[model samples]
Target: MKLTTCFSTVRTRMVSSQPKYELIQEVGRGSYGVVYEAVVKRTRARVAVKKIRCHSPENVELALREFWALSSIQSQHPNVIHLEECILQRDHLAQRMNHGSSSPLYLELVETSLKGEISFDPCCAYYLWFVTDFCDGGDMNAYLLSRKPSRKTNTSFMLQLGSALAFLHRNQIIHRDLKPDNILISQACTPAGSCEPTLKVADFGLSKVCSTSGLNPEEPASVNKCFLSTACGTDFYMAPEVWEGHYTAKADIFALGVIIWAMVERITFVDVETQKELLGSYVQQGSEIVPLGEALLENPKMELLIPARKKSMNSHMKQLIREMLSANPQERPDAFELELRLVRIACRELDWDT
Candidate 1:
């Protein structure tokens, strides 16, 4: 349905409507929701607002998961997308609900997520509004592919992404879908055509929070130790274990490895669905180029060329990427160690900041 129908529906439902944000234009669209470039009425600050229609069970679950994952993070990281607020919208008969700890709407949503079904009336139209930081520089895929390959940009991105993943893991959040399309580039405060653009890891609809028991105050439970059975993610970015429906946070690292390696070598493939040339690694199987994870799952002993191309690449960086993409998850370094190793590699590179 068109977004105009959505606004009209809301207008008919509410008697005294006071919208907090003004929608400027439609930014993106997914299966469950539509994202709009909006501006806060009070502060005149730009924000991206995601309006999710909780019409189906799958849509509701995805919306709740995204909300839960984003809301669960108490501390903010520069490299991660920041959630400003969430507003639950119902019919005119019911009151609009602002997200809070004690909101019944939230409790209902949580129960729905756990039960995998909606408890309320199936005909009752409800919506979840997520207000977040607007990225003007667009997604990583677009930003990187539009520019010439540069060591400085690659090093900067590596450090930023490593730090972001470390922060998420420490917070017990695992971003199952980690790819260039999901990662946004924010050029806020930077001048036009500036070299430095802040990376913001976003789209946590498939993310999982790994917070179980068995943890000491001195040393908390590592995210890598938290095993999950959901085989959900882009085919190209999934780890070998993820293909088997059993994996941990290390899967995120493997996905990042694919992105890093592809970025360094400028390897690209056209997405059949979107017809967009996306940066990622793939294995040649006869005439078809299959995902690295699927290829590794079929043959665990297969070795990948770290550099993919006969170009200048740092030995340390190459080795680290290789380890990160190891078929065995145990051999891959955790997010914490990945950050440290990336820093060391960046420091060793003579033209890291060039």
Candidate 2:
């Protein structure tokens, strides 16, 4: 079982000498650093603090990038991580003597990470860190692995995820990594037993801001010119062009498609070995994906997903997934279009007003 719950009762463990916040315990770890739960001394508001040991120049740059990525999108959308502030708390006297400086990030507290990465331990944790809102629902990956969600719950999650991604794409931000691990769930208690699960897209470490100023002045200065050339992100969801070093927002759409497919079908398409094989193929043969529909053929796990697709998929949702995972990035619908499509499907499937 994932580590979650028990954080509220833990005694305060100060990660830094900063008097304003008190640490509760370690909660989760992101792509680059460790995360902890903290309390604001004045208001006693709980928050998640991320700690990074800045030992080198590259580490320093990564810390800044993560800070700015979350900070830049602050208050921009309800579904993004809220960065409270950043701080530089000196490490231990011994460690500080050797390292020379401190680096910690502060953020608003949510319930839990989408992956349920919190376990209330009584022991206090002391580490240099940053803070952000805590997410209660853990992460999408854990939730799906635990159990298949109710149709109603799935609708709510898809709506929030699509809306959040739409908001980001509109702001010209590419969330290079949109896996289940990065999508958090916020469950609100409502009269209907609970308000729909609200998903917060976190871990912007791989995200990039699209800009077009570097191109030749003679050419058009379109923001779309800001193409990413890195072949990053988890394999199962990677788009074809990502391997070729030329991709855009549509690349994210491809990832979203894979995510939604796994979400509804309750299956993990490619295994770790397959991921390595495909990555090797791309590195050696310059080919990323096999072909459309080849996903079911290539991954044995698709046996379950194939049946689920036939039984549960309606025309609209199926069409959307297929289009999003198309071989041609241009053929994929942008986030806005995907959101609209999901909204319509949700309204029809859930019989709720749009």
Candidate 3:
């Protein structure tokens, strides 16, 4: 409880109805809504607030979906965004949190997004707001742009990211969108007395929570029948099975594979539009799309064996990544397995018996 706020009161408004927190600044805006940095009056706890409007039935439903997903995940997953509370009523004309149809969400405050730019886009013409903690360290993509990452640093990132995925999968939740922009970083003290950037998985707009106990993969995929088919997510990182409309939680692991490859080589994953077109062409011609592993190997700069390039890790790590990007979803390891492998890599790098 650091009782200090970020933005000043001259820019903030203290409303009587919601006396506990003060709206500080309009920090960000996206396709869905705008984000605000607010602070609690008594405890002075700073938080991010997603300001959304419920003008139409579609908007209201989207707001409900985001609120449900955010509120549900916060209870069990520490790596996920923490939702403070959902303020279900915000009169658009009046500009205060009164009993209305629109909802605004309160969340933990973090510093930056993976893009490193918090400049408000001013495109929130829709309804509903969602909130989450501010991640100070920025997203992994922005961080990578700032500097090349060492193997150990990237491994730490992979470990944390995998751990987060493990928690979500165990809870029967599937994060359909797992890209660099959705992954955030927070500053934390490591065992070596160093402040390090730890990964926090963000953005659950396209997430899926299985109605059935989502914990077991061995169970019939039709048990809950809810989490069976998901043809959603960024195309470049999407698995083939996902493209075919039959997949499980392993789809996320495929995205993680693309992320790991990018982390190792300091490369941006392929564009979504290109991925879609290529996959679409394959669909039109009834041809099987080639795996991304071939494309990665073909990249001259991403030669996993270039010893001169101290930026990337050894080939064994590349091999692990290949396993993650398997064409068949079943061949891909689960988050738990990936975490174990990352642990082994960490231990080996530290010279501990694994």
Candidate 4:
């Protein structure tokens, strides 16, 4: 049986007994899955393999969302994570679940997502494997904090992120969760021996694609108009509207603002879950650091003290960030405009050499 998703038709079947990729080492692990550093046995090209066990509805939903979002995007962007392919394994049989294809096992996953819990034989376990590019540098938080602060790195990252967000928005995708940890870095070195890295926005489990249909047939539907009510995102990176249980793509702008602000000032906080210091912006209230979203929700009119840590900051950049993090989503600029502003700021105001 074949299943048609909102994006495309599913077609997949069982593959040969030969293993395509050989696992090398464990790279990372989370609640849903474990990531491995692997390589293709035939070509010996390095790739990151994510093994996700679909044991529950929540896990199935998250896996499908990531698969749908990445597979739906026909043209890949430089700063966005590239999904090479997906393989589904059940018992001793393995099937290649390529984009726009599905099998009985794949359909079973879709049913599990829509119909909640399903019965799986005790001996049979379903696992989905996602193979993608292997980021050598590491996550954004570790990469930036490992080295001394540089305006060149900051400017480059800002431009790259802006471009990425703009591309996603253009494709009508809203990344509900945007944080430093979700952003990966691919290491690179310039001819002048400067540390330059390309940013890849990963983890699309919370991403949503806005519908193209609009109230008016003549007017094109804008991602900004597609409001989402579910309050989902990292606490420190959520926008005020998101905290209130309603927001649009503009929430992404606010999250990006928090990241760029913390990155520029080198502000960090310890993550309660991992007990790791992560770079992110938050509001200080009575000695305790509070989420910026919650603080704004309590007092919408409250003014933020821009450059709270830095003694002096660029006037234009400060203003732009303030607008991006504004309490009102309407006040925040969309991703398209943000990309233009970032480019102008990098070229005119910021000194690349410094």
- The deviation in Å at residue 46 for candidate 2 is 1.8
- Alpha-carbon lDDT, every model: 0.84, 0.60, 0.58, 0.85
Residue-level lDDT of model 1, residues 1-354, one tens digit each, is 122222221323232444567789998998878999988767888889898988777887888778878888998999999998666766533333333455665677767877888877776678887889999999999999999998888989999999999999999999999999999998856466555699999999999887665655556566888889989999999999999999999999999999999988889999999899999999987889999999999998999976777665777887898899999999999999999999988887746322
* RMSD of candidate 3 to true structure, Å: 10.0
Off by over 4 Å in 1: 1-16, 93-102, 190-195, 214-220, 351-354
**lDDT of model 4 at residue 145?**
89
Q: For candidate 2, lDDT tens digit of each residue in 1-354?
A: 111221222223333333556778877765467887777767887777777755433344455556656655535677777776554332232111112123222220111112233222223232224567877777787666676557776787788889988888766678888888788777667886855567889877677766536546554333244688877776656777776678787888877877777677665534455341111111111544332223532442332222233465676776787777776777788788889989999877563211
Write down the TM-score of every candidate: 0.90, 0.71, 0.68, 0.91
lDDT of 2: 0.60
User: Which candidate, 3 or 4, would have the higher lDDT against the true structure?
Assistant: 4
Clashing pairs in 4: 10-101, 10-102, 11-101, 11-102, 12-102
Please tell me which model should have the higher TM-score, number 1 or number 2.
1
How many collisions between residues are there in candidate 3? 17
**192 Cα displacement, candidate 2 (Å):** 8.2
Task: Give me the runs in candidate 2 sitting further than 4 Å from their true place.
Answer: 1-18, 89-128, 191-195, 212-223, 269-308, 351-354
Candidate 1 residue-wise lDDT at 153: 88
